[model samples]
Target: MPQAEVDTPLDNAAVEARRAAARAVQTAFRNSGVHAMLEVATTRAAPAVSVTIPLGGTSGSPFLGGTGLPLPDGAGPLQQLLEHHDIHAQVTVIELGPDPALLVALTTGDDALRLAALVIERRSDAHDAALRLSGVFADLGITEDHIYVADGAVQVGDINVQDAITLYDVLTGQRNDAAELDLGDRWDPRTWRDVEKLAELMGPVVSKAAGEPLDCIPHPACRTCISSRPHRITLGSASPQQVLLLADAISSANSSSTSGVSPPTG
Candidate 1:
């Protein structure tokens, strides 16, 4: 009978090397302004990490008047909209899988009913509201192809890193283009793994930088409707530095066999 093959356990040196690698990855994430928690691999799952980046917004209520809304020194489009149109809303950056999308929660009324009536009645008020909302998004650097309106919300998908950074600056009173990071040319990820990892890291960072949450109004009907569906946000951009760091970490972790360094396997 052939002998059963057994996996060799990592030596102490190999184990220490893996630990150092993990610490390096964690430090890199921290330097990029993201908080990450590393999860040791289990029998049923691979090693993973969860991150929390600064997303500026009201924590309790996702409304402008609510606590923790980072108002800019100058009035941006969102502020302008509230001051001029009296449209109470919330703006948040969210992650829909590997994509980053923008969510604009319109006024807390029966938006579905109002929008439906506008289609039939052809009322100028509703039409004007839609136009104004579109303009607001446009002023925020959202293009037409990325915009979608449904269920009383406006979602802008496929936003680049610059767009998110600009929004963050507007909300946090930071200098625009402070990082000088233009990720447009490097936006296309080399692999799905890279895409997924970038999504995981960038989502929280961008969202925190923007500081907003998707606070839907507490209308019974609307709440039910919202609960019935899943919420999604898409991010379409990542910095080259971020990508390179992530790639290095992933490569090191995955090449454990060749490097004789076992990854965290709990």
Candidate 2:
């Protein structure tokens, strides 16, 4: 008969080191002012933190065409109609998980705030758009409570710091997969291309929001929010000294986001 295996307790120093690392990451994110979510890794997994940074920007014209496909035409009917009504619209498409979701930010020149009323009108065509948008959230397994819409932005996703770091590691060739994070097989690193695209699209927006250029690095030492440039440092490429310098320079910035906003129920 085989004897059962027993777990070895972590040394006091090792335990303290782990606690210190966790606290450092949390404090860095808190001081940086960007929106981030913290999740405790499972006991069997390496202790890690995941962060998600939402990104959005203005669209000059309608993104979708008559057939519901994206079009590059600026003279589209929707654009003309919106222009006629003096509404300024900004649209961003983001894929944090599997499916892409549309975020439409609308503003009007008039002081009456007709565009705001249109967003809330249940009987209008906006209701159909809301349902379609809601379906994207459903596909991503996001609950209504986690959805936030305010200040011309719609933010979805649980926004885990560990997951973001893992994905960044995988993207930058620092790791093959997030297996050490124990996020399960469903959290496939291969399918995170959309996430990369989202980061690329929103990198400028995040930089503007942070009031400085930022880079996406897996290590917690870099306090900047997630944004990438051609010369951005990765965990696989940065030296300990460089990482420390980045931590100091990036820590000077602040970030913020709206929370507890009610999601529209259509």
Query: Local distance difference test, per candidate?
Result: 0.35, 0.33
How far is 200's C-alpha from truth in model 1 (Å)? 7.3
Flag regions of model 2 displaced more than 4 Å: 1-133, 160-176, 184-266
Q: Across residues 154-236, which tens digit of lDDT does each residue of candidate 2 receive?
A: 32233333434332332233333333443232233433443344345334433332344544332211223333211121222
lDDT (C-alpha) at residue 153 in model 2: 28
Let me know the TM-score candidate 2 reaches against the reference structure. Answer: 0.19
Candidate 1 positional error at 149, Å = 2.3
Highest lDDT among the candidates is held by which one?
Answer: 1
TM-score of each: 0.26, 0.19
